[model samples]
Target: MKDQIRSLQRLLAALSSRERAALLAARPAVLQQPRPRTLHQLAARLLGTASLSRSALNLGEQQFLEAAVAAADHARGPGLPFVCGRRDLEQLLGVGRGVTADRFAEVLRSLTALTLAWPDGDRVWLHPDATVLFPTALGRSAHGRPPLPAAAPLVVAAPTPEFRPATGDGHGSGAAALHFLDKVLGAFTEPWPALKQGGLSVRDVRRLARILHCPEQESRLWLHLAVTLDLVTERHGRWICTERVPGWLRTPPADRLAYLAVALADVQILPGLPTQDPKLLNQSFATTGPSTHYNAATLRLSANYSAATLRRTVLDVLAELPAGQAADDGPALAAAVHYRAPHLFGPYDPTKPPVPPRPDPYGHWPKPNVAEVTAAVLRETELLALTDRGTLTDLGRAFRRDPGDHAALRAAAEAALPLQEKATILADHTVLVPGTPSPALAELLRDACDLEFRDVRTETHRITPGSVRAYFDQRPGTDPQQLLDALSTRSTTPLPQTVTYLVRDTAARHGHITVAKAGTVLDVRDPVLATELVHHRDLAHLMLRQAGPTVLLSPLQQGPVLEALRAAGYAPNSELKPSAARAADRSEAMYELPQLLLPPPRRRRGPGVAAPGEWLADLSVDEHEPVGELARFIYNRAPSLGANDCNVLATALGAGTTVHVEYRTPARTHASVTVRGPRLDHADRLTSAAGRTPLPLSLSGLQLVLAVPDGRGRPVRGK
Candidate 1:
C-alpha cells in the first residue's frame, strides 16, 4: 500500500495540478474494491443467509435475480450478447421491462473487475478491465453495480467503455502494434465507400500510407485488421467500410484519415527521389528517415497541386478594389495570404482563396496552386462549406466585388489563357493604350506572350495620312499616290483620294488661320468662300479684319456705279472699288483702297454747287461767328487755346487767309507755326487732323444757324 501511494505520488508529481486533481477524484469510482465478487456470487450468498418466509420467497425479488442471472449466462455464450432480457426480467420483478430493465445493470458492474471482452460496432474485442469510463450513466453502471434494498432484485450492467480518443499515441506502445492498428483502423475509416456512392474513387491504402507517413506493409496490415473487426467489409473486389463504424465512433477517425488521404491522393512521384525537390512531400519526416517503404510503385499518386516557380509577387490585390462581389473570394484570399506573408504568397483569405499561383522565373515569391489555395482560404474563413461545391458565401461575394481584386482576377484570368488568346483578350477587354500601358498591364501581357515586347513605340507615325491630306492640297507636282502609300503604310489604312481631296480643299480655305481674338480656328484657306458659309463666318469676320473684304467687277455705268457707291454708304469722290473691279474697269474710271483709307466727304452748297470761298463766307457769318465768340471767351476766360496756332484767330475773324502764330511749348514752352491753309475748305481741314489736333478750328467743329441775309456788306448769311 505504501509503495502504491508512493507510485501515485510520483505520477501526481509528473502531472499538472489540475490533472492530478481529476485523477485523484476519479480514482475511488474507477478503482475496484479488493476481492470484488460477481453479482451472481453475491446473490447466491445472500439467498443462503437470508431466512425468508414462503410469502417472501414468492415476492418476485428472487425470481427477478434468477431471471437476470440466466440472461447474463445466456449472453456469455451468445449469438448476440446482452446483459439482461426485456420480458423475462419484467415477469420476475413484477414490473414493466422499462422499470426492471435498469435493475439488471448490476451484473455488468460486477463483470468490470473481471476483464470481460466484447465486440464494439467493429468486431474488435474491447477489454472492460483495461478501459476508462467517461462520466456518463452507462459508464457508471459499468464501473459498479447499482446499490439495492434488502428485498430488491439484483441486475447486471452492460459492459462498454465510453471515452474520447486521443490525438496521438502518447501511451507508449511498439511500432509493430501501432502499425497493425493504423492499417486495420485506417482501412475501416476510409471514405471510399461513402465516396463511391457519390461516384468518386476511393484513394488507395498506399496513398493514404504516404500521407500518414507510414509504410505500405503497415497500411495493408491495418486494412486487414479493419476487415477482421468488420469495420470494413469487401464488396465485390473493392474494399469498403461498414456504415456502423461511423455511428459507433463519437468523432470519426476518418476525418483525419481523409485529410491525409487527400494530401497524398494526387501527388506526382519522380522516377527517383532527387537530392533537392520542390515538393514538401518529397522531404523525409523528422523521426522517420527516407525508406523504400514508399517507393515508386506505392508513391505513384497524383498530386493535387502542380509545381510552380516562386518570385516577387505583389500581395495587395485589394489595394484598388471597390467593395462588393460574388466571385471576390479568390482575390480576398490572395490579399489576406499576401498580407500575412508578403514574402510568401499570402494575404490569402479563407473566405475566398486565390487562384493557384503560377511558375515564374523572375517572380519574387513562390507561386502556389491558386485553385487549392482559394478553396482552402474559403474553407478556413468559414465562407464556404467543405461539402459545398466551391460556392461563395454572401460575405465572400461582397469581398469579391472590390474593384482592385476584380482587376487582379481579370489579370489572373488573362494570365491563365493561352498566349495568343490572352493577348487578344487583353487587347479587347483592357483599357491599356498602345504606348502608355500600365506596368501591371504590360507585365501581364509579357507573361502571357512568353516573350518581351516593347512597352512603347518610338519611331511610330503620330498623325494619320488622312489628317495630313485634310490640311494640305494635292498640288500638280506632288506625288499623290506616293503620299497615299506612305500614309497607308504608316497608318492602319490609307485615306481615300476623294476624301483626301475634300479634306484638302476644305483645309486649304482656312489652314493658315489659328487661334485669334475671335475664337478657336474653324476653317481658313478661302477667306471669302469660307466666310460665305456660316460655319466659318465668325472666323471669316476675323480674317476679313486682317485681309480686308473681297469685291466683284462690274461694267462702267454711271447709274450702277452710283447705286453701288450709295448702297455702300460711300461719300462723293470716295468711291473706291476693289482691285479686281478696278483692273477690269481701266481708264482711271475707278480705284479701290481699304475702307480705312477712304478720303473725307465734300460739303454741299446751293442748288447746283458752291465755291470754297463762298461756302466759307456763309459758314463764317452763320457758324464761324460763334468761333469768334468762343475764341474771345477763351482769350478772356482762359488764354490756353490762343497760345499756339493763330489759324483759330483767322477763322474767328471771318478772314479766308493763312496765319502765322507762335507760343510757348510744354517741353521748350516755345511754339511756332507758319501759314498752313484756309481754315475751311470744301472738305474740312480738321478731317485730315482728326485725333491729331487739340481742337477743330473749322465749321465742322461748330453748330451752324441760318440768319436773314443783309442786302449790304458781302451778303450776310442767315444766323
Candidate 2:
C-alpha cells in the first residue's frame, strides 16, 4: 500500500500545472477542501474516501472505475494497486460488439486524465480508493466476467391512439397555478413568524397549506417558488411580500406564465433559498423530490449540472416527438436525455429505486431518483402550459427553443390561450366562466365568490353568504353594492335575484355581531355607576365606553385605566390575560425585480485550461524558451499593457477570462501568476488562483498583463 501511494505521488508530481488544474477541475469536491500544498497531499486528496464518493462521473466512467476496482480486488487484497492491461480492462468492462475501440479508448483517456486511474507502461494502474465508490457490487456474467455495459434505455414513442390532441389552448393549468401562486404571495403581504433556521415552522406550513387550499407537500413547493421568483422574501426573521408583487400581479396571464416558466427552469433544486450565485443554487438541491434539506455529501455529488440544463435537455428531447405524441415513460425519456449529454448527467440507474438520502440534520424528506427528476421536469412543463396532456404544445416548443426570449414565450402563449372579458351569470347564485376571464374580472370573482371547480375550459364560482362575508371582512370599506357594480360590469347577463339577495343579505350581517378591542373592562354592581364611569370627566383620556348596564370598557391598558378610575374616587379590581412580547420593527430593503425584463439564467463559466496535448507538449520545451500556456501567452504578445493597467484586467474579469499577470514580489524578483476567473475585490486586490494556489495579488504590483487561451486552447482576443 505504501509503494502504491509513492507511485501515485510520483505520477502526480510529473503532471504540469495545467494538467493538475484540469484533473482537479473534475474533482470539485477536492478543490472545495483545503488546498493541497504538496504532491503527496494532492494524491491523498485524490484518493480520499470522501472525495471518491462525491466526484461526479458519467455512467461510462463509473463503469470503467468499477471494472478497475473489481480487477484489483480479484488480483490482490483491496489495498494493493493492480496493473491491468487494456485487453483485460476491455473484457472486464464487458466492452463487446456494441462498444467501439475509439469510444473505449476515450473512456480510458478520461479516467487517466482525471487521475482516477493512470497509465503505467502499456497498462493502467487502478487507485485502490475506487473501492470506496464501488464496493464489492461487481455482478459477474455466466462466464464469471463483469456484466455488460448498462446501455441507455431506448425512448419508445407512445402509441398513436394514446395521443390526445388538446382541443383548446392549454393555458388552464398555468392560469390556475398562477392564481394559486398569487394567493400564496398575498398571504405574505403581512409579516409571518419564521423559525430561527430561516424556514417556516411545521404549524406555519400547515396553516399556509390550509389557506392556499393546497396539500401540505405541494404547498411547500409553491411557497419556495415564490421565494425563488423573488415575489416574496425573508426579512427580520419573518416572511413578507416583496415590492415585485404589485407588478407581478398586474402582468398578463400569458406574460406571467412566461416569467414563471423561466423561473422554474432556473430552479436547480427544491426547497432552497434564492441566491445570486447560480453554482450555489445548482449545488444546494440533490433531488427535485419533496426533500426540504440535503446533506453536503449529496449536494457535492449532484453539482455536475444545473437544473436549467436538465430542464432544457428534457424539453429538447420531448420536442423530438411528433406534435401530440409523448414519450412512453419517464425512465426511457431520462435515458435518452442522459445519452444526449452524458457528461452533464452523473451515473443514474432508472431500473433501481432512488437511493434514500441520509436524513439531513435540519430536515428529512423523500429524495428523487433520475426518473423522478425527469418526471418532475415534465410536471413543471405541464404546470406552465408548455405541454398539454403529456405532449409538447406550441408554447412548449417556443420555450424549449429559447426560454430566455420573454417576448416569444408570451407571443406563443397569447396565440394559444383564450381570454374572455365577460362571464356567464346563472340563477341559483352560480357564476360560470366559459374561458379564462380578464385579470380584473377574475380578481373580482375570486374576491366576491367561492370557487367550486376549475379546469382548462371552464370555471365554476358560487356566490355564498360565508364567502361574501369573509371578502367583505377582509376589505374594510368595500360594500356589497360596490362588489355588485363590479360584477355587473364583467357579467354578460344581468345578475339573478338569488345572487343579488345573497350578496346584500351577506353584507348586511357582516358587522352585525361586532368584535372590538378593549385593554381593560370593569364590572360595576350598580348600572348607574357603570354608566357614570363611561362618561367620567377624570377618565376622559381612557375613552371609556359601556358594553352592558353593569360593564364599563376602556381602550387604555388595565394599569393606567384602573389607576385613573381609582383616582377618580372608585376602586376597581382587575383580571388580565398574559400579554405576549411584540417584535421590534426594523426596516428592510424591499425586494424588486432586477429589471423589467427577466434576467437570463446565469451560465456558470469554468476556469480556462490548456488542452491535454498542448499542456504535455509544453512540458518538453527548453528552460529559457517559452514553456507552458502562460509562457506561450507572454511570448505571443497578443496585447500587452502596464502591470498597473486596470482597463484590460477589468475587461477580462468581467468576461470571466483567465489573465496572465506578471508582478513584482517584495523580494524585488519578477514572478508571473495565471489568474483564473479573476475578480477585483473591494480592497482592489485580484482574488483567484496563481497556479494551484489561491492568493490575493495587489493590482499595483503588476508589471505586465495579457489574457490566456480559453479552456479549448483558443486564444482570447484582447483589446
Candidate 3:
C-alpha cells in the first residue's frame, strides 16, 4: 500500500502539461465535464488516482467496489449484470440490519461519481474498465506485487476474539435446544394438527411457547432453523417436522447443539419481536428511543456486524460488571451492536440522555432500537444456553472460544429422555412412562392426548385423554376385550371398571359402519348412508343404489363422496386407513424460507497484497527537500521507459512515455488525459495511442510531459 501511494503521487506530478492543466482545472472547485466528452480523457486518469484515493469512498463502499469487481471478473465475462442489493452488500460488509437502506445508496452514489460505476436499470453496473481501473485481486501490477485482496472478508474480533474459561456443574444447559425440539416433536406428532397453512400461526406459537416455557420468538427462530435445515417439512398446508427429528432425538444432546449451531448460523430470519408486548417494551425504554418497529426488526437481521467488535463490546461491559452478573442483557448486546456498526447506528449517543430542562446533547442522533437488537441476539444465544442472565454462558464460550470442548454438550445430550422405553398401565384412565418419552410414544397416546401435570418431575408420564374413544379402534386386530387383556398384561394390578367399560363402549361403536373402498367408490354397511342416501338430493345425482336400509352404494370417489354428502347437510367424518409413513418425506415437499442464507464470503486467500510496481507507487519521499531529494526520488520511481517530469519535461520527450495533457472537450469541460508517444503540433494540440485526435488544446495546456527511454537513449522529436 505504501509503495502504491508513492507511485500514484509521482504519476500525478509527472503528467503531461495538457493533462496537468486539465487536472488543475478539474480540481474540486471546477465543474466536471459532462459525460461521453471528458469521459475518455478522465477515464484512465481517474483510474490511477482512485486506486490511491480513499476520499471518494467509505470503508463499506471500498469493500463493495472490490467485491463487485472480483465477482464480476471471475463469474461472468466482465460487464455482465450482477446483483448489489441490501442483502449482498450487507453480508459482504459484515453489516447487520442496523445499517439503513439509505446509507447503502449513498455509498453506491460515490462509486458512480468516480466513473467506477453507473446506474443500470434498477441495479448499478460497473464500468467495463473497472476490472483494470482498480485491480485489487485480479490484474497484477507493473511493480511485481499482487493487488491487495479487496475487503479480504474482514475477520471479526478486533485483533482476535477473546475467550473466557468455562465453568459449570458439567451439566450444560440440559439440552435446552433439544428440549424445545422435543416439544416441537410433540406438536408435530399430535393427532389434532395445530398448524395453519404449513406455518405455525402466531397463536400456535404462543400456545407452544406457553407449554414449553420458552419465548415465542425464540421458538419461532428454532422452528425456522428447523425448516431451513430440512429437519422439518410442509405438507397439506401443515408443517411436518421431518424424520430428522427422530434422528436428532437419537443423537446425543451435545451433537444436537452442534447440528443446531450449523442450522442457526444459516438462519437469515431475524428473531421477530420479543415475547413482551411491543408498546409496553417501547415505553420501558426512555421515550421510545427513536426506534420504529421496522428499524428494530431490521437491526437484528440485516445490520452490518463485526464479530470481533461484538466480542469486544460484550467483554468490555462484562469487565465493568461484577463477576458473572450483568446489569442488563439487552444493553450488553446493544453495546456490541453499535460498537460493531457505528455507521448503521449513525451518530447516536447511546448513553442515557439528561432529564428535560437540560439541552438534549443526544437529541439529533439517529437512535436505532439497540434494545431490540440486543434482545434478538440474546435470545439466539439463549437457545444454546449461551447466555445466563444476559452474560455469555459457559456453553456459549465453548461455542465461541473453545469449540473443541464437547464435554458440556455431551452432558446436556445425556439428560434428554430416551426414545423407546417400557410403559406402565394403571387402573385409572392414565398411562405411565419412564424418562422423557419420545414423540413416537406421544403420537401413540395422542387422541388429543396431552402430557398431564404432576407434582413429581421424574415420576412416570401420565397420558391424559378426555374420553375412552382415544384408545379404542375398530381396526382389523383391535377388540375391546383384547385391549382390556393387553392392559392387564402391562399392569400387575386388575384394570379398573371405568377403564374396562371405556374401551368396551368405544370399540362397540368403532366399526358400526364397516367402510370398504373399491376403486373410487366407498361401500358402507351397518345402516350406511342407510336410509339417508335414498332421501338425499345430492346423492340422487350420483350412481346410488340401496342394498337394504343398512347399506348404500355410491360411485363417487372417497374425497368427493364425503364432500357431496356433507354438502347436502349430512354430518359425516372422513377417515382413511392410517398410512405407515406419517408425514413421510415423500408425502410432503420441502419448502425453503423465502430468502436463502448465504455464508459470509471466505477471507481472501493466496498472497500478494501489493500489486505489481505497487511498492514504487506508494513509496513517499520527503517533500521538504524538493530541490534534490524530490528530483532523485521521482527519477528513481519513474518507469524505466518513462522519465519523471517534475525536473525535466519538454527537453526529454520520447515514444511510449506518458504525459498529462490538458484539453477542452466539446462540452467545454476541463479534462485531463495521460497520453503516450508525445506528438505536438504548433497549434498546441497533441494526440497519441488513444487516437482521440485533434481535440482543442492550447500550448499552455501542456503542463507536464514524461520522457520514455528508448534502448539507444535517443529522444523522439515531433515529426
Candidate 4:
C-alpha cells in the first residue's frame, strides 16, 4: 500500500511547475471528494458489451434477475450482505396473492444454478460480483436492518377433523414407470405410426392405455416420459425403443423410479403444475392432439431457476401457512403456479411453417391454466405429510436441496413394487401374479411367457406353445423340460400337464413348416398354399409354378416373393438365416438409448489476467540502435490512466468548476497558459470555457501532464 502511494506521489511530482498550474486548475473535479459511481456507468461496465453471452438465462430468467436486484437495492441493510424476504420480492415485482412466493423461488433457483445467488431459509445472498449491477448501493448508509417482530409463544390449536393428507403411494406414477418400458417395447415390436408433426395420434395413445390399463391422459404422460428419458425415439415417422432398454430393464426399482421422477420435471402434462387434477387433461395446454398443446414441454422450472429459488419459495409458502397446515390436491397451490408461469396455461398458437403466425386458428380457444405445478412439488417433496396431516410418513424435505434426493425417490419406487414374486399356476396352463411385478422381473417373465393382462394391481401371463417355442428359439439350445422346471420353481402349484404337453408337442413340430428361398424360386412344402397361390390375383403376377402338390416356385427375389405371399393369403415370418451374421449384431445394437438435447452444466471462470497498458512512457533511439531495452520499458512497463484515474478527470467537469492550464506555445517556449473554468467532458478531454474547442490534455501541445486542485470545489455556470 505504501509503495502504491509513493508511486502515485512520484508521478504527481514529476510534472513541471507551469504544467502543475494548468493541471491544478483542471483537476479539482476529481479532488473535490470521493463519490459513488452512477448507476448508468456501473451497469455499462458490469453488464459489458457481451454480458448475456454464455449465460443460460432465458427471457423469464433475465426478468427474475432484474426484479431480484431491484428488491435487494431497496431493502439493503448496512453490511457486506443484503437479504430480502419472500414477501419483499413479491412486492418488488408488484405481484399479487396469485403469484405465490414459490414462483419467485423459481427465479432464485435459476440464479443459484448460475451461482449468482444463494438462499438461506427466506433470505437470499447474492454473489459479490452481482452487487455491481446495483451501483446505488455503493457507500450506502450505515443503517442496520430493523428489528423483526418478536417470536410469539406457541399455542395449541384443535385439529381439523375433515381433512387428511394422503400419503403418496406413487402407485399411479410408479406403475406408469414400470409399464412405460413395456409400451416402448410394444412400440419397438410394432412402431407407432407418427403424425405429420411427429406427435402420437389418438389411436396410438388409446392402444397403450388399453394395454397399460391406465387412462389415456396417464398413458400419454408415460409415453412422454419414454421420449424424455430417450428410452423410446422416433425413426422415419415411427416411434421405436432404443438400444438402452436391455440395460434399463436390469436397473433397480429405485433407480428406475428416480429416472421416472426426473422425467416428471421433464414433460409438463399441463402448462400450470404437475398435479393429478381429475380435469387436468381437459385443460387446453394438456392436449394430446399434437406437440403444440403446451408451447413446448421443453421448458421447466428446475432447469431455469436456481436451487435457492426453490428453497426460498418452498420455505416461505410453508411458513406463511403455519406449521402442520396441509394444502393438498385442490386449488391450494393454484395461485403459486399461476404466478410462476402465467403464460404456461395461456393459448399458444404455434407457428406452423408455410402459415403466417399473425392470425391464429385456435385463437378462440383459451389457454390452459395449470394448477398442478404446486401439486407436483408437493408430490415431489412428499411434504404435505409434514403439514396438517399427522398420518403423514417421513419423506425428508428433498426439494429443499439439490436436484432432489434420489434416496426418497428410490424408496417410493421400492415401496410401490410388489414383494411377492410367487405366481399361481392355473389348470388351463396360465399364470396369475397376485400383484404387480418390478420392471426387472416383468421383463424376465415377458421373455418366457406372453402377457395376458396387466392393471394397476395385477399381472397375468400364459405359457402358450408359441411363447414356449419363442423362449427356446431366443435361447437357441435349451431343452423344453428345463424351461418347464424353471416355471415349476416359480409356481405355487404344479405345472399343468397340458402346458408340458404343448411345450413338448410344439418343440417337436416347430420346424415342420420350414420356408426357405430356393434357386429362382421361393419354396414351401406341405403348406397347402399352392391352390391359394394359383387362384390369387396378386400371386398371379409372381409367375408361380407348382413343382409338387405342396410346393410352389416363383422367379421373384426373396423380399418381393415374401411381399407377394403376404399380399395374397399368407402370413410369412422372416427368420435370420445363419448366412446373415450381421442380424445378431443389429439386434444387440438396437437397444442403445437415444440422445436428447440437454443443455450443458453451469460454467465457472477464473479471474482473467490484466492487460498491459496501451500508452508508451518514453521513446528514444541512438545511432548505434541499442534501444531495445528502452523500447521495452517505454511500451511494456509504462502504466496508463484507467477507470479509477478517469474519476479524476470527471471531478474537474463539475458545474462551476475552474482550472489553470499549462500548454506549449507554437514557438516551443516553456511558458504557462491559463484557461479559466474549463469543463472536462466525457471523452476525458478538456472543453474550453468558450464551449467551442476541445482539448486532449496530455496531447494538446503540452510536454508534460500534472493536475492539482485549483479553486477547489467550484463550478462555472458558463464563461
Best by TM-score: 2
| Residue 320 CA displacement from its true place in model 1, Å | 17
What Cα-based lDDT does every candidate model obtain? 0.31, 0.61, 0.46, 0.47
Candidate 1 versus truth, CA RMSD in Å, comes to 50.3
In every candidate, how many clashes are there?
A: 70, 0, 50, 38
Write the residue-wise lDDT of candidate 2 on 1-719 in tens digits: 32343456667667777766676666664453123334543454455422343235555676667777666555554334355665666665556655666667777777765667776655677764555566543663324445434432112222122233445446556666676787888788889876555656656766888998866545666776787788877778778988898888667778887787777765655322122223443342322223334343122224445566667766766777665566655566777766545565446786786554444576543233455556666665666678765667778888888878998888887755567788888887888988677777777787778888865568899888877887888887677788888778888999888888888887777786767788667778999877777777887888878888898777666666655667888866656432311111112212234767778999767655445435433332112333344334333332222212343466666676666665545653446666766765677566763344246766545544555665455546433
TM-scores across all candidates?
0.14, 0.43, 0.35, 0.40
Cα lDDT of model 4 by residue, 622-647, tens digit: 11111344323322222222222233
What pairs collide in candidate 2? none
Q: Which digits, one per residue and each the tens of the lDDT, describe model 1 over residues 1-719?
A: 11111222233234443542343242232211111012221111111122222122211223333344444334344222234444444454444433444443333322221212211222212121111211121212333544322232432322111222222211111122323343445544544532223211224544656654555534443443344345566565345667756443332222222222222212222211121223543433211111212321222212222211111111123222223212234444444334323322323344653443333486232334333444333332221111112223222232244413433333322221112111122211221223322234333333222222322121111233343443243232344444444333323333445534543454455335543243222233455643353333322222223323332222333333433444545332323466544553454344366577668888644333333223212221112122444454433332222211122443523533333233222332222333233243344332111222333333312211111122331323211
Q: Which scores better on TM-score, 1 or 4?
A: 4
Poorest stretch of ten by lDDT in candidate 2: 580-589
Candidate closer to the true structure by TM-score (higher is better), 2 or 4: 2
Better candidate by TM-score, 2 or 3: 2
Cα lDDT tens digits for candidate 3, 291-395: 213222222323334322333334344444445455354443455545444443334344763221211375232323445545556556665665555555545
lDDT of 2 at 636: 37
Give the lDDT ranking, best first. 2, 4, 3, 1
Q: Where is model 2 more than 4 Å wrong at Cα? A: 1-171, 271-306, 309-313, 320-324, 337-352, 359-368, 425-432, 438-719
